[model samples]
Target: MRRVLGLLVVVFVAIVCAGRDLYEVLGISRDASSPEIKKAFRKLSLKLHPDKNPGDDEAAKKFAEVASAYEVLSDTEKRKKYDMYGEDGLKEGGGGGHDPFDIFSQFFGGGRQQRQQEPSRGNDVVVPLRVSLADLYNGKNIPVSMRRKVVCQHCHGKGAAHADDIQTCHECGGHGVKIETRRVGPGFIQQFQTTCNKCGGKGKIITSTCPVCGGHKTNFGDVEFDVDVEKGMQDGQEVEFEHYADEFADRSAGHVRFRITTTPHELFSRDGDDLWMDMNISLKEALVGFKKNFVHMDGRIVEVNRNEITEPSQVITLKDEGMPKYQYASEKGKNYFTSRLLILCIGQLNIKINVQFPDTLSAEQKQGFRELFAM
Candidate 1:
């Protein structure tokens, strides 16, 4: 009663003063609206959310600051008062505010607790996918079929031909788990849940089973998926297919992750999304000139014309000819992955020169070579 009355009195008597520094903490203007404030809060929360930065006191403290700022800016009256009288006003209002941890939970994983028995996600299936440098350069999708555990199509995961034959287990009372209390010591006890012995952890049992899948809800079957090989994707990078690996009755399917491995390409050698190759040039061609169209990984013709004297280790760099940038860039923070494409960075292929000489020179060619050396 005193907390509420005291707050009302303080709010009524609150006059003008300076401002609280919450805006600075959130990196927003003093006049920021609710959406701008929320955006700032979300950005900080994603960075400092406890799950992402577990056991770190510094991140926890930073997250608290973000939550505090959101608390003040979120409420219009509190914001007005804070803007007018700063921290002193909050003190005068008797300090009724949110718990930072509570706000953080609500922002991240709080609502999940209110949901009905959540389905368990199956284990992630990791496989190595071999690819060529050309696939990475051109960006192609390779179709692959993997035999995985998936829900039975005939039973639709019910494990029974007739839905009416499925009945709830009387032992666990439709709950798959069985809880039992254990005596620890004098006046001490422990409780735990285990798989119900009657239904075998399945809340329901089928009297008449499906002919195709037998009684089990899941069966190993060939699941086909396409791997979209992106340009510039690093070797051993994971390409994930959500909920496509393993399946269980009433449980969410686990993800299928492909760790990309590159096979030795015949033409180009890759290095962290960049490519390099050697172009052999004959003595006559290096000295005089040459013009030809080189086929790129995507089958596009790259025109190359060399007219000047070529050095043994001279390199020809073609901008945007390396590997395509991976898709990860397009997703993270709004406009965080901007590439000054014109700047000679990744995606530029370097073709080096390896000059060749004949084993033996003809008399006329030797005389001409001698003349050229003399000049």
Candidate 2:
């Protein structure tokens, strides 16, 4: 009876060991394809890699298990046998085993195919660009800095350490979509289609995750670009950089938009294409005459002189002294100066009649003097 008990115990142990699912070791379902199995293995391997988690025996064991799972699933013939006959099929060497990377090359086409495939575009970015009045007057090139995501250099945007790490999706069976039926009411049902849950609608999976990017496959870094400000551009204008956005998955490169803002100037006030300024003159200068020199916008000295007596509130117009015409074939503008005159009385004197000079003036002259003084 004891001998019989020992045999039964052996049988039970075998059954328990054989029943352990290999899919769990690779963190995947039994229906996972060759590519999906590889992708999952690579992702787990990187996290539990001996090089990354040194001195951790558990992690090392996990990494080994992941590698082993990839080795079996990546080979088509071996994978087929494993799917049909379990692990025992490979013990007799009938399975035509191949390297995991070779299987990836065959399934994905080739190296050239991977490179020629279109990558997802990035997002468009925008920023406010401030410019000086002078810059606005004569366009300029402005440099800008920004941060954005770029494809990972280590994995080349594959999101895996190697090609062998990719796997076909089990949930959708590589179709990338799933159909479902839901009961709307008694004896009635509605059908709808949705992306596969297992593959997240991609119809594929990463067996081995990229060690450098950890499956993110992108890095954040600084980007510098130059935007051209066109001449004669008005305030609040925008300059666009075509296809210069931050690179990412799911879309093509977008544009970088720059909004232009003109800074205020102390010396000049802009009115359309004309510039205005204030000039002051003394009252004496206004009554008599005055000549003055002022600086133009281009730093040239211009002299303005007035010889005629300028009356109070009289305006002096300077032709062509305004701002340059904007895209107009005209160079005419009026600069007006309003004069304010202040008259001053120095003194007043009262003198005796000069016509009777020396007390010997003629009677006619005296009469004339009396008459002039009477009024």
Candidate 3:
């Protein structure tokens, strides 16, 4: 009996050593990255899937091997064990018992039928964000803080203390719904289906609920995100954070959008990419000539001078002094285009002159003004 046991151990070691390399199975190198491994697995799985090649035992076996290889390599700890100790190391680390079909289904969005049964997205959340004109003019990253529903950290959204604590509901048989018959009239019956009361339409029962969320599988947590206000962004433009809304168990999180709303500025108003401001000037400055300076939105001092007479309500155009033109995704990051094309797209600043007149003129001042205007 001892000899036979020794021989069995030797045989097992030989089989494990002779087994094909997992990397070679997926057609990737030993140094392949996670994304590379995933890409290779996706390609091979698509071609060797049982649905694609039915009744081919060879393809089916290869598909299973590929799934197993990906399952190990995708996990950081499992992959480290496998790399050091091979199959025996994996066994020692409690690895390599996952269902291959489950991994495959999850990677490919649960096949076609399971995808249809998956829960829809939750409700989207939109919040209004107020920004100053200076922030929009110079581009800013504003940090926003809000409370949102996130998956419970304790149970990982399982709603149970342990995996074994969850079991299929007996009343609905895991269908999440039950059929009932009601008497409508004499010798007549109406049948209808309704959510299972035992499972609360979840099709599963938790023996012990999660302590953090109390079986709700989610909790409201404070989250902070940055809202990028690009230069020349229009009012009411939405900045979307995908999958950042309230999360619920078994459902995808909806998107969160922050709609940009510019606060009223005391000096400047914007239209498209252009900026307009009223410049108050004394009557002498408008009639004779003057040089004055005004502060721009970005704290730059803009100088305006008129050697000739300036009139009230006259608009002066300052080229390339307003907001910077927004660089779209398609046109961004090109050095030559930014230097040549975008440089010419800056918005103009229109300065509307408003002349202040004196309430009354003395007789000597009126005579001097009349004599000066007579010239």
Using all chains and alpha carbons, the TM-scores for the candidates as numbered come to: 0.54, 0.47, 0.63
lDDT of candidate 3 at residue 140, scale 0 to 100: 85
**Candidate 3 stretches greater than 4 Å from native:** 1-119, 179-195, 329-344
Off by over 4 Å in 1: 1-119, 153-156, 160-208, 220-222, 327-335, 338-346
Model 1, 1-375: lDDT tens per residue? Answer: 323432332332222112437898789998875546766786686576545564675665666667777777777888888888776666776644455645644543333344355367888899899998777766667888999887888888888988899999999987989999999999999999999999899787778988878978788998777676766677887666666778887788777888889899887888665689888888788888777577888888898788888888899888878877663322222232222231224568899988897789899998988998996
Arrange candidates, best TM-score first.
Answer: 3, 1, 2
RMSD of 1: 14.9
**Higher-scoring candidate on TM-score, 2 or 3:** 3
**Residue 41 error, candidate 2, Å:** 52
Model 2 residue 250 CA deviation (Å) reads 2.9
Error of 3 at 363 (Å): 2.3
* lDDT value, candidate 3, whole model: 0.76
Model 2, which residues run further than 4 Å from truth? 1-123, 181-191, 302-375
- Per-residue error for 362 in candidate 1, Å, reads 3.4
Name the best candidate (by TM-score). Answer: 3
The candidate, 2 or 3, that scores higher on lDDT is: 3
Candidate 1 lDDT at 31 equals 81
Per-candidate total of colliding backbone pairs = 1, 18, 0
